[model samples]
Target: MSAENEIVPPPGAAHRFAVVGMGATGVGVFVALVRSLVAGGRAAGAEVHIFETKERLGAGVAYSTPHDCHLLNMRASTMSVHPDDPDHFVRWLSAHPGAGPAVESEYVPRRLFAEYLQEFFEEALVEARQCGIKVRTHKSVVSDCREDARGVHLIAGLDHFVFGRVFLCLGDLPSTAYLEFTKLPTYVHSMWQGAGLETIAPDATVGILGTSLTAVDALLQLRGAGHRGAITCFSRRRALPKVQGPSVRYTLRHVTEENLGRLTDGFTRQLEFAEVAELFRRELEDGLGLAIDWKRVLARPAETFTHTLARDVERAERGQTLWYSILDATSEIVPLVWRTMSAGARASFMTEHLSIWSMFRHCMPLDNARRLLGMATDGAFTVASELSAVSYDEEDAVFQVSAGGTTHRVRWLVNATGTGFALDCSDSSLIQNMLMRGDITPHPLGGIDVDFDSLRVLRRDGSHSARAHYIGPLTRGVHFYTNSFETNLANAHSAVAAALN
Candidate 1:
């Protein structure tokens, strides 16, 4: 190894730590690791290496958007980096008045959250330095990682560095589902990649794939830019996300650890899908004080998209959606529920209820919902379900999208289908290389397999790595609730604790 790559510890330091990726997840790991080390009197002369190619460290892809139109789905009260302190983000917002308005119950722009994260990270760096911890940042992508006797090795470009422990906090991976159209000038595969939406002509028709939150973001951006084109959001189920209502504090009774433990016989038995469904049913009915009309909630409504949007907005405005509050309360125990489930149960949920579940669970803020309703009423765009197929016309330079038994031609096609979880199909060389070397294995449901409690990566041979821990959205299959910042932060603390132990 070269002199720079040598694992020589500083004069008083005995261990070196490396965090791959400087997104929100990475920032969480770094902060948690620093705090843990300082508390344990191990921070003196310790080295922390952060690897990322992005100009901004903590913004990541989700919060990196500069547009004010893209708002956070969660309210400000719950968007804190410290899991124990629910008001941490709100306090930060209070201190930084120039960032944006601070309303604990309101959904703020994502850029503001990005600023909070960057500031939080900077503060952590200051603390780390004061405690005699050496911080190093490598502005390069980690292409591969391998763990052996010496330590965990991270290969970034032509350079290699080994650390006593490595935390892989790489954020969401872009969807490769529509890679065929990637080369086409009219098709934008990843919406977050710079200035893709700005290239669209003001009057040209646009077709957006997937009606998830990302699709909502694209539509809002197009509208904010004063695009006069008719935009159509295409999806297989044709269902838009539910709108957020007034925040309500709910204490979980059904989906608690005690209940789960009893159901799983102290977690020795795997839970069936039906068992988990019953728990949710009971919880929802208990919260609403009435039996739920499951058929109505699950079935595709006969009402048009505009009608559904309006009704949901009205319900949200009235704060009559107690089910949402109840569901939100269950976020803490979702991963435990997922872990107790049998493999067959997990597979069944993924194939059967994933779409509808996502629509209800991952909701949009009321502000965006009202904006979408107005746009729909004004005939700016329409959401179409039953997306059958799509084809590109080379000579015409337009996309032909077939949905709901009608073919619509659009000059621009945007894929807002959200992040891809398939490891083998990932665009990241680091993930692909790790998979190839048997350092990690794909979870059957989604993401990479990991030890649930420790957050350590599980290899193809069914052994957990001692020095490597994986966190972020890629742990979705294992955690089932890894998308939220709070969950990722908690997981980071868990991973760092395990690493230190």
Candidate 2:
């Protein structure tokens, strides 16, 4: 075996595992590990340690929001915590009618999802206990982690613990953009932070950065709170996310494992960008039974933002968005395709196609889109492209935002640009400390480096830590679709299997 893949004996108990950060990813890893231990006949006297600082164990930042307007992007049918069982979450929601309506194909409020995760986690804990497994929870942030000859050492504030294996599921990081105005009360660096949009006056003009889903959330929250001020979304492209349509299941033909195997000659070669694009083209064309206008699809629409949104809504209502269904069907194989691509191809996609790709892939719910359309029709919201500069005037207590060759002044500027992937700019001291100690290395494209198969974190010297595994959105560099719950859950299972093996 390669030196990096070598496994060492546990210093103490063999079944002791530690999961740092009890978000969705961390919860997945913990549950998978518990089930694996029980299935492998190792549950007797087995112990699992969970470390998190959040008030809610499994909610994390993504679903912790109490706003009903902040809806999940994906449908409930696909948001199962169990990768193998797609109906797990839906079943849970059915059992608890007070949580929210259980529409399997509909997008529910994120807070409802949070309740689902917490309840699922509670059930897992009960099952673990019944199986003679000891589950422990720590309400402290993990400040640092280091592996030595003994075991994996985790320092959480004043306390310290050791475990046979450690899974890092730190979730998404806050955006590091617009740091210069962080001290300004009017400039909100993160929309998820404490009392985010509530501080903005009802009549305050707002300028939100980026036209991603996060920006959509900000706008919806503002509207939900009865904000009557005009809001302008600023971004380089200013293209809003596509609206999700009816859930249609599609079987892939071109972007399948068999086709990929044939193209790579049994996994001997890296795939070129053009080759992958052609496969996608074939898949979309086959699904639609018509030729796709690549230029028209990729290019920014000439119509106004409201018109485009209305048209997308109409198309979605008519179920004419078969292409989106086709794209969604390829989610399972996306990581495999990404891993097989040459580095140049991956970098090229990140540089040129990531924005547009995200705009389509991470879409808003039809409900939210319709509400945004209403706001647009009321002349309270607009999107501007070609965003250049933004500066704050202390005397005037307003922000000057330059975009589309016009400068607009707003009372508040929000950095709704979404998650930041740069580790150097991470807000977590644990990640910062790990980087300083060479416990982890950053990926060239983004996030930290990890073994694509085992999810073991690779160190500065290119050696994989035997006891440390990272599975979260920050692993996007290794798995392109890590943002999705399904991908993260699958990764959690893989990491547990590797750790137990």
Candidate 3:
């Protein structure tokens, strides 16, 4: 490409900024961009473009549910978009009566959180307008992105545009691919897509893939819709997420940054996996005021998975799991710990500990756990561990799932396995194009590789791309906590600061 063609700026445009995928992550980036542009006195007639194919911009797939049965996994108190205010969303909820009660400790519906995000986005836009920034929304898919000396060029449909910088705040990747079940009428690739769980027959024997939060959402939706068929959830570990408990405040001890420094010998070298694990063990013990029974938790020879879940829920009900706050507090320094870990240690964490970490960290609400236990006790739901050899019979139009020497057939299959992060395995055209052109490289753990702090997309040649910045779950391999709104918002702030600098 010629320098003239690539280096040219948009006509009459000063400081053009583009944010792709206007989901929760994108909205957070938008807030950071507006604030940075306005604070830097660059918002006068600055052009800001947001691209999304969804009807709504800020809600994203996670929060776009209209069902009242779906609830936010976290409490209302901790979901603020702005870190400085800390209670902005909670305060907004207090002011708006239509959003149900504004109790900070309550687990509000995801739709209510969506409303809060939309309102927050609009308020930010209004502030942008006050500073003479033009905010434009493009309801279309971004096909390709290529960078040059001048800026980044984004292709949306037949239209092409260049921006000073682009924030690829792309939300969760597409659902996991099921090549064997492709073209089968009974197989649903994604439960979050069009028609959702409603497409399943009311009396059909339904098989749900994975026992994560997504599976729980599907289960609740099906129950709410009056589905009475047998529902079996497949899990490799047969472990359901623990229940969310009442708000607990605790002091940090062994997980402190100072302790991390001491462990690393004043940050002279990379951290080992064992050292980090030991620190966490101490943290839990100190925070809980009781030593955790590692042997019982790991072995669990006598208790069922559902029984373990019930025990945790019971602890939550009795306000005894104050140790949960330790994990909550770890959020502040997770990036530091994640980045300093050796590559091999990081990979070990991904392979051996990630699932258990998720089981504890991404727990469901207590009410949801109760409902799940109730359904399990009623014999309407069954969870199987180590499900292997999932095959579909085209003639019978049934999916045969095998686990632990038992085979079960279901007429309907739902791939609620949640989003996959492997960039090479991604079916998205834009991501594939970027990888093909070396605009981004795949991380060893998962997702696209990027810089440790700023999140600038790193090319195959080990150079960072000035044109593109990624701030999403894809960065989890390096950042370790990109799944939360708090982490994404923090990432956006850092990216914007780096870009401005």
- Model 2 per-residue lDDT tens digits across residues 1-501: 788777765555456889998888888888898889989999988889999888898888799898988888998888988666888777777777765453643788888888888877888899899999999889988999999866888999899887889999998788867778888988888888876889999999999999999999999999989999889999897499998888888999899999999999998999999999999999999989999889998888899999999999999889888888999999999999998899999999999889988988888888899999999999989999999999888899999999989999999999988778889888889999999999999999889899988899999998999999999998888899987988998999999999988
Q: Clashing residue pairs in candidate 1, if any?
A: none
lDDT of each: 0.90, 0.89, 0.83
lDDT of 3 at 376: 75
Tell me, by lDDT, which candidate is best: 1
Clashing residue pairs in candidate 3 are none
lDDT string, candidate 3, 82-158, tens digits: 78787787888888787754354478888888888888889899999999999998988898988985579899988
Candidate 3 Cα outliers beyond 4 Å, as residue runs: 1-14, 101-105
Q: Which residue pairs of candidate 2 clash?
A: none
Candidate closer to the true structure by lDDT (higher is better), 1 or 2: 1
Ranking by lDDT: 1, 2, 3
Off by over 4 Å in 2: 1-13, 99-105
For all candidates, what are the clash counts?
0, 0, 0
TM-score of 2: 0.96
